[model samples]
Target: MRTIVITGGTDGMGAALARHYLGAGDRVVVVGRSRAKFDALLTSATAARAEFIAADLSSVADGRRVVEHLRAGHERIDALVLAASFVRQRRHVTAEGHEASWVLFFVSKFVFVTGLAAQFGAAERPVVVNTAVPGARADAIDFDDLEMSEKFTFARSNAQQRRANELLGILAAEANPDLAYVTWGPARIVRSSFAGDVGTAMKVGAAVLGKLLGQRPDAAVRPVIGIIDAPSPGRAAFRGAKRRPLTIGAHDDKDAARLAAAVEDGR
Candidate 1:
């Protein structure tokens, strides 16, 4: 059986994907921040095929620890699913001294995938799937203020992080042609705690929109599975379950190189 690693697998789409992979008879390793939640998730029969690791990915150290643990335990990883993410109402800095949202959504993911590059290379068919919205294609990466110290807004930060995911995927694909990197955007909002920290108005509005347009958990996860199982490499964002071209803002090769350098330096 193939081995699949999923971060933030205790709840939401991550949990759903974990269950789906378990049902398909794959060995699944779920990484999350809560031991209680992991225990609760393991109560099912399919839990036999699953393992859990707890880490607060908002810290780069914790992210590296997870990658180290995986490297020590597994010979190869068939799929690495970077699905850990959350939206906060305001900016919060973690003990690692970086903005919490950026750490979890972008920094930690970059570290994990790059750290485990060797294992991925050893696999028969390795794939990395990042679950992030492909926000405005014109969104540019702020090199001087990646942590959003200058000005922070939930919308701007989220969009920037999403854009970073797409650009990172492109760069990663170029660096490791043997590995398939796929960035996926949700087709519609699903009922989850993702927006629990937002203001009341946004919560209400999200609820209404979800009720009107949200796809069921199973339906939403199908495209993710398709991306993982795709025959060819996926180097762009997938929206509405189809591949779409990415638009990197004014940043060119120099910008991408700078971003890569930053990620390496941060690690």
Candidate 2:
């Protein structure tokens, strides 16, 4: 059985994907910030080969620690799924002095991929998938002030971080050609806690929109399941349950290189 490591597996799309993978008899590792939720997930999953790691993936140090912990435990990882990103009400910083959402959604993912590339090498042909939205492709990245302390617009931050995920995937794909890097649109999950941190206005807006068009947990797992088992043609975003390709955005070689440099510079 191939080993799959999924972040943010305590709830939402992550948990749904975990359930799907476990049902398929794969060895699954669920990583998140909640022990109680993790335990509950395991209890519900009841996978003989499932494991959980309680981690605050919002810190670079924690990301590093997770890799060390995994190295001590496993020989190889077949897939790494980043399903832990969220939208916050306001700008918050982690103990590691990073923008919390950016750290979880972008930085932590970059570190994980980098660490895996270093440890496992290109021979493993691991798959890396990051969940992003349409917001990412239509925005610009703010490298000067990552926290957006001066320009703390929620919409702007959300879009920028989403773009960061794309850049991360593209750069990682370029660096390790043997690997399959994917960024997909989960297409607004109704059960996700995405708008939990936002104001009442957005919360109500999201609630109404979610009720109208958002897919259920089971409905949303189809694309992710395809990513885990099926072969995608190239670097493109999967739209809905059919796993149909959608032309979202292209990664500029220069921009990808710049993002790679910026991530290293941040270290």
Candidate 3:
């Protein structure tokens, strides 16, 4: 049986994915911040194939804790799914001293994937799937203000973090030629606990739009399953079920390297 590691698997699309894999007889270890939510996800029927590790991924230390736990237990990882992401209406910094959204969406993901690279290399068919918005291109990373302390806005932070995730996929593919790195975008906003933390107007709008246009969490997770089950060459980015061409930023290499350095520094 293939072993899969999933972040943010307590709720939303991540939870749906955990159930899907458990149904297919794969071992799923879900890492999340909430023990209550994790308990809710575990049922008598699926408990045998599932495990949970509690972690608040908004900090680098917590990210490393997860990596260490996995490395100690599993020698090989068939798939690593980076599905934990959220957008906060106002900017908040974590204890690790980085923008909360950026940490959750990009920084922590880089730490987990890179920290677990050796396990990935040991696998027969290794795959890393990042469920972040695709092609949200950014010109470069602002070295002086990586956290956007100067003028932090939700839109700017979201765009920058999404771009960072895409660049991460490229860099990861370059570093680990044996692994398949895929970045996926669900395209439409769906009903999620994340919406509760946003502004009231945005929350209402998303809820309405979700009902009208958003794909259900189960439906949204299908493409991710496809990416995991069907191995592909190199790196690819997808929106929904279709492959879309990505626009790489001019300073992507420099930005990616800088980000990698920051992750290594554990900031």
Candidate 4:
């Protein structure tokens, strides 16, 4: 059986993915901040194979903790699914001293993937899956003021974090030629528990948007699962269950190189 590691598996789309993979007979290890929730998943997941690691991805130390925890038990992971992300009400700093959202979405993911490259290197068909937010293209990343405390807009913050995820995925593909990297965008999925963590303004905006255009979380996972199961060569992005040849994200070789370099510099 192939071994898989998933972050943010406590709830939402991540939890959905955990169930999906485990149901498929894969040995699944879920990483999250909630011990109670993780334990509950373990109890209910007897039909499928599953394990849990309580980890807070918002901190650099926790990244190390997660890696060590996994290494102690799992010798290798066939795939790494990075579904751990959070929305902050305010511009908060993580224990790692970086913006909480940025750290979870971009920095920690980069560190985690890079640190565990050796594990995937040994696998025959290792793949990395990153979820992208489609609306993120509207906002540009502000390297100068990452915290966004100056002018925090929920949409803008979400967009920035999404863009970071896409960039990181591309960079990951460039860094590891043997591994396939895939990014996916689930449009207007509302069945997920994302509403609980967003800002008040965001919650209101989402309520309005939901009335206009929102989809069930299961609708989003179809495409996400496709990317995880069948990653494309070069850089590929998926929407729904089908793989799209083209996406709005920057996926050129130069952009991917730059992303890799930036991630290395951050280390």
Best by TM-score: 3
Candidate 3 vs 4: which has more TM-score: 3
Q: Across residues 1-267, which tens digit of lDDT does each residue of candidate 2 receive?
A: 778899988788888888778877788899888778767666454657888887877787888799888877887888888888667879887777777877777788878887777434423557877776633553467767776877887778778877777667666766666677777776665656662466888888777877888888778878777776764433656655434343344545666676667777873
Q: Which stretches of candidate 3 lie over 4 Å from their true place?
A: none
lDDT of 3 at 30: 96
Top candidate, metric lDDT: 3
Residue 15: error of model 4 in Å?
A: 1.0
Query: Lowest lDDT 10-mer window, candidate 2?
Result: 242-251
Model 4, span 1-267: residue lDDT tens: 888888988787777777778777788888888877766665454535777777778787788788877777777778887888776766786555666777777777877777787787777777887776433552366655655767877667777776666666655665677787776666554555563365577777877776567776555577666665765545566666656553354444555455556556653
Q: What would the TM-scores of all predictions be?
A: 0.92, 0.86, 0.93, 0.81
Count steric clashes of candidate 4. 1
lDDT assessment of candidate 2: 0.73
Candidate with the larger lDDT of 3 and 4: 3
Scored against the true structure, residue 60 in model 1 reaches a CA lDDT of 85
List, residue by residue over 114-233, the lDDT tens digit for candidate 3: 888889888888999888777775663556677889888877777877778888876777767988988888866656666336888987787788788777788888889999999785
lDDT of each: 0.80, 0.73, 0.82, 0.70
The superposed Cα distance between candidate 4 and the true structure at residue 17, in angstroms, equals 1.3
Candidate 3's TM-score: 0.93
